[model samples]
Target: MKRNIVILASAITALCSCNDGASDKAPVADSSEVKTAPENNKYTSQPLVTHIYTADPSAHVFNGRIYIYPSHDTATGTPENDNGDHFNMMDYHILSMDSVGGKITDHGVALNIKDIPWAGRQLWAPDAAFANDTYYLYFPVKDKKDVFHIGVATSKTPEGPFTAEKEPIKGSYSIDPCVFKDDNGSFYMYFGGIWGGQLQKWNNNKYDSAGKLHQPDELAVLPRVAKLSADMKSFAEPVKEIKILDSTGHLYKEKNNDQRFFEAAWMHKYNGKYYFSYSTGDTHNIVYAIGDSPYGPFTYKGLLLAPVEGWTNHHSIIEKDGKWYLFYHDVQLSGKTHLRNVKVAPLVYNADGSIQTVHSQK
Candidate 1:
């Protein structure tokens, strides 16, 4: 649900502040100045989507174009609601970058809270993957009981009037649903947060409904995985506490914050190696480690992206044509930590197989 303190603090604040157990509704931006990024080869500092607040960027390439699924940020509409300072998102918008550089088109709301039968008000970060000739959107939302469950929405096309499944993917209770397909054509579901993370790989090319599940705040979690069934509505083959390494080459969690993954788990397979990248939970920085396999005893690498002022530093890495780009968000639009704007920068690799520190500003 967040990057750094303001968002994490806001989420923790929202989680703690909500007497009724929900994210606080945010206050609307008042004449916020939007920075127009300079057109240059160095970097594109400005947000790809402006005019409205967006957060939790989930970038995907479809039909030779880059399609981004971002959570909508809006005002709470009431002065008393967390002073209008919160994560208050209820829907998602599908924005597609028509070209590699500039020009982002708002395809409007792809899915709404009202359409989701089992979802609560705070619709958080969402991710989408294309498979079986269908676009499946993975979403996490707080239930009425204030517990978050991962759900999948389906659409015939990229910009969709998506139909959400009445039931969420069972056997897991975490946020930020990221789905990836390996070279072998098998699907893997990666999820979990804060206290730990999880990873699960698909078997026989389908999801199993009877796997184990855990809460987002579970202290024992560590990159567990589950099979994303072909139907995309269930999961199975739960692996528990797959070890992630700290800087000292020991199990993660044993150490403190330095080079430790706080939350926001993203997986990328490059050069026949698995790159497990995540946000450092103080919400200020992003770091990654590499392992020989997807669920691995990964060696702690280095920081991927430096901290942005606002809060969350969630990012996605994708390749287009022959170049790689990083999709992340910043609080530049409204200057308030929670009201974030999505930004993109060219991401490149070093000869040593490690990622370079992101210079997102021009």
Candidate 2:
């Protein structure tokens, strides 16, 4: 297994190495129904770990273990709120477990914000995957200009002290970078956000490729799609604009635009159907659309996971050992939106190939 990794980090000796460990076509037994030791809360199992808050969970199953790469939510600075005062994140920690209800191990901080030459302080939702034996971590952070740029890091192991490339992926600017490696071995990248094209340009402003400033309306930032070259750092083709639904779906449109997909674009292939799932920002429901190809003429499906208590809902769906799990975060512990904790629950599919809406406990 180690033979396929690209060990680029100089501190190979310091990499967080430890024992490590979703989703479904068939009926999966409710994890809450598993009947573990009774607890005061509705959830039967605890948040994978509580050492610190983590959000925007991206789970990947590699070598039969479910590895989670989540943004490290912090309370060190001002509290996080809806007005974007603080969503202070600086690094990512890799968490993994052998199975459900098992010991969740901390693989340590895999990457840090300070290491990236172009990165600003905020390190938001990120993702990890294994392709061609090398594990790649895709992360997003605002540069000095406060523009969100998606970047990549490589490691020989899933849990690592990864070395990041000096520059963000060219022609790529957005948050919540999620990459899906299809069954046929092709790779695709998805990213974007709202508020005048991803975080309101950090100041309700807009800028062109030359960093020239303008009003938000001058730029339109929707979820984006691109094919990744074999190296995983550059685009194989020009990044394309994508829409979750089209005229095929019965929905009203003003000049054919729909904001159903707010952000957190996650993709997975199940039973030959491409399930394009994402979080609807303003409304706060994790919804999905179905597509026949990686690039889609998609048909919209309803909620996979409904709105939770938190203001923001970011999620990832995966199938493990014939069962599906939807990983998301909520402000259950801190009672504050920014200090969110990651949680996982079983995700099921309906007969029509749509995902079931999950009802979670507080």
Per lDDT, the best of the predicted structures is 2
lDDT of each: 0.67, 0.70
Give a tens-digit lDDT track for model 2, residues 222-338.
467889999988889877766566446543232222335667889998889998888767677787888898888567867677677778888898888898878888765566677
Q: How many clashes (backbone N, Cα, C below 3 Å) per candidate? A: 18, 15
- TM-score per candidate, in order? 0.79, 0.80
What does the lDDT read for residue 205 in candidate 1? 28
Please, what are the lDDT tens digits per residue for candidate 1 over residues 56-162? Answer: 78888899988988878776552333212266678887878644453567777799998999987578788889888999998877677655678889999997868
Q: Output the number of the TM-score-best candidate.
A: 2
Q: Which stretch of 10 consecutive residues in model 2 shows the poorest summed lDDT?
A: 12-21
